[model samples]
Target: MPAVTRERALEAAVELLGAEGVRALSHARVDERAGLPAGSTSNWFRTRRALLSGIVDWIAERERADLEPGAMPTISGIDELIEGMCVMADLQTGPFAARTRARYALFLELADDPELGEPLRRQRREFERWTERIVIALGIADPVPATRALMALGDGLLLHRLTVDPELDMRPAIARAVRALAS
Candidate 1:
């Protein structure tokens, strides 16, 4: 079992990351946000890298949980798949907005400093592989390339929506892509 303190610290890190950018992240901020003793976060994460790693772990687990049945995406059919795509594209504007922003915050930082993105990329690859499975299960003839296409499209949609238009609704386009892939 994971240590409760570590989890608490990571959760606080998520909140801090969401509320502020990565520049604001530090042992002291996390400890204060988590309501822990001054040195508690430092005990768990001796360095900034370790702290980031923990946040990545927490995000992976949290996103996976959010993907469970009855949660976001709610994948069951093509329509649900479309909803899932839209949900992800719309991640920056809801109750989970802060965490969504936090995830992107990491992505922004990693873009400039690629090394720090290893864990983030690993988590993303896992999701892409899962998407590959879903595409294959749908009887798509070209599952590998199809998975790449879908992921790219989803990523593009998310990035565009977040940066260009917060109200941008690409569900129709996403649905069209799904139909094209299925056909």
Candidate 2:
């Protein structure tokens, strides 16, 4: 077999996180998942933290792409903005829900570890920037407040979904929050 490239290894890492949670994402496990030799991942990443940083960057890029221009459009008015946010919430609460939860759990784990905290903090900042852009595009007069509210709402909804019925439709809950914010 050919050598496992960085991208391939990161992809395997993301899938492994989705399948077996963050604890299963060591260099050795990623190497095994990618069908590479024992030391291949270490050769590329040097350490588990390095590999995790790469994985976090990869996932952030993917999520940013998914939320960009066409995927997440700004609306003309408050009603439309609410609708758009509802759709965004639905997207998170739907097929990608498990991955989101897994990512958040990994984030929490990183938060407790000093070595990983900076990278996770950087990721959160990037996400906040993205949310600010979305809020501005949505035509909110003060995007920062709306952005903060939306972030809170999104986090709360995700936590609720994870703790309660994973199958619960989040549209109504999100719609209510969006309307409250847009008003």
- In order, the Cα lDDT scores of the candidates are 0.79, 0.73
Clashing pairs in 1: none
lDDT of 1 by residue, 1-183 (tens): 238888888888988998788999999999999988898999988999888877876887787776566664435577777777777667645666667768889988877666667667777887887787778776877999988989888777766765678777788879999989988
Worst 10 contiguous positions by lDDT, candidate 2: 115-124
lDDT, residue 56, candidate 2: 73
Candidate 2 CA-lDDT value: 0.73
Please provide, for model 2 over 1-183, each residue's C-alpha lDDT reduced to its tens digit, 9 standing for 90 to 100.
234477778777877886688777789888898887788878878987788777777777777677567876656666665676667666666766655765786787677776655655666677788877756776666788888887888788777766687776767777777677656
Which one wins on lDDT? 1
